[model samples]
Target: MAETDREIKDSLVRAGRPDRVEGRHVNMPVELGSTMVFDTLAAFEAARAERYRSGTLYYNRYGNAASFKLETALATLEGASAVTLTSSGVAAITLTLMALTAPGTHLLVADNVYGNTRAFCDGVLAGQNVEVEYFDPMIGGRISALFRPNTAAIMFEAPGSGTFEVCDAPAIAEACRAHGVTSVFDGTWATPVFCRPLSLGVDVLVYSASKYISGHSDCMLGVVACSDADLAMRIRKHVMAVGDKTGGQEVMLVLRGLRTLDVRMKAIDAAGRRIADWFAGQPQVKRLLHPAFESCPGHEFWKRDYSGAAGLFGVIFHPCADDDVRAFVDALRHFGIGVSWGGYESLVLPVRPVRTAQRWDEPGPLIRFNIGLEDTQSLIDDLDAALPLMNTGLEA
Candidate 1:
């Protein structure tokens, strides 16, 4: 049995050794092989039979020693009993959903979840008769009222995309536990370094290892960590059933990234806060939607739960024309226009708030910014030059 969350976390923090691998000193090496050879017929049979149980590894698709090592590291960090890796973040989430719910089960998700996630719920899960109801990201404790008899789980994103509304995760988790429903939080933003969702009562924690974990944006991977052994088994079964396995190269990349995650995260936190402060003072920026900012929704919850904020955050542009955004993008020198973030370089992207039946009046156009390791002065300079280029902001 695992010890307390603190003890588990300490073990995880100490397990990351980028320079050492398989008793070798190579910094990085691909554990590429679809098959694993057994010592004898009985060993092969035993491996085959033990495939369904924990502590046994058969093939790469099921899980290899390297994969399990990475999983253990993640589980240790998140204070989880076990973890499952997938080819992509979407696969991790999809497998988790399938493992946790049946065809008739219902799910409550934040309206502001990732676009692809919403698509999965509406297009795939809904088609299979799994009812998904969208809830306000700021619903907080009131989320309990939305629970139905068939509700199986609640999926939430902290500081949800486009609009940076941080949800009260503890309140939501408490409500879920009271009703015998499981809760999953997309911990891609905080990772284990910043926030420990399992410690905060979250049943399952998921992450896009492709982002901060990989750090280089060259590989794609996902991690699903769970505290319950039974739930972990279900997740693993679903992962294997769906053929959702990450490549050894990606796993190695994530391992390499883990070695430097602490240093990178600290740099990101400092630069991100400085950028958020800069945006707060900008005339063209109407609202700085970073959790560190006082005006951010659920700021108190974030301050209480999160050890630090990462690079990603949003800023609402003062009411301006679309052409102004075009000019601003063209003027930017350092910030690249892209979708994925958490890399060494900075990125910016225009995002339209996903409007639902509940549409609150937003102030202006929104742009999500992922501040990188670049010098604060240089990033500020780039933004300063781009602000006046907004054609729509010329007069009105």
Candidate 2:
């Protein structure tokens, strides 16, 4: 059977793990340290030369057995040529952007990208003299018209940050290939479970593992999975140069999370869809921002490209008083008002995406929800109670 035909869920448990040895345990042991001593002078020199190579355990920053294993497993799952683990999601985005573009090069970014990552383009990349340009997330293949001679890479997030807008990725990838520009994608929302960006013709797929891959919301990690060996090597060299490292303990945690990702992702997918549909029928909700819904921009592309939807999505509410919005948020008993999502616990936050390329003249008071593994009715009931609060101010 073809690799695609094989059960990916089974691979989640077995990939990157060695076959069981009679005397050894099933899971690989996590190793922690900075330095490794070699017995022979020749061996030490050889190991030092090969330190930058994957799984070469000469130094802690380079990576250990666990790090290599996680990288291998993630690469296999994503159908990527190689993988690079970084200290944080910000590092992964910055490093890829830094490595791809230089002082004179140009970058095309989606206006609705993660605000934190978008700031780097304005700040650090600006300091480095790289020209950064933001474009409408709905531009689709028309993005080709904006490419300049100095254009190096285009980084975008599908089902974008804060406001969920799915860009036309296959079209964008085609444009990149024609223009000889690199395409970097933030595939955190879909991951490898719901969607694989590499298979969609994207060059690099970066993810924030702190959210779902770590599963428990305890690990702070970023991952880069690339299709091109040369490009992957360039990013890896930059990672080494920056002395960025992901601890073995975090790798173990991520691996543990990966074991159940198939089940959790699907469950969350189902729950989020049900809730997103529920929000659409509410009197206060002006529009649903879910990519799977027909009302969402580029929903057609999402249908054509992605295998399924992720738990993260947004809901736009009709004009509401500030006090009422607060009452609605405060009224929720189960949903946590938090920054990040993709944990076992559900999260809710009011979102106002600052867009430069396009006007975000949607309905007032957009609320984003990250559905968790909670009981469907309980969450719906929690929202059902809160929906009334959007009209009535918080009781004094």
Q: TM-score of model 1 relative to the true fold?
A: 0.93
In the range 1-396, model 1's lDDT, one tens digit per residue, is 224544544554456444454677433467777888888999999999878554477886787767777877787677788888889888888889878878999999899888778889888899989998999888988998999999999888887876778888999999999999999988898777788888888898887998887888898998898888898888888888878778888888898888778778889999899989977877777788898888888889889998889899988777877887888887899999898888889999989877573685875778888888889899999998788776435333
Per-residue alpha-carbon lDDT of candidate 2 for residues 247-283, written as tens digits (9 for 90 to 100):
8788888888888888898899899999998887777
- For each candidate, the alpha-carbon lDDT, in order, equals 0.82, 0.86
Off by over 4 Å in 2: 1-6, 392-396
Residue 325 lDDT in candidate 1: 85
Q: Pick by TM-score: which candidate is best?
A: 2
Cα RMSDs of all predictions?
2.7, 2.4
TM-scores vs. true structure, each candidate: 0.93, 0.96
Model 1 pairs in collision: none
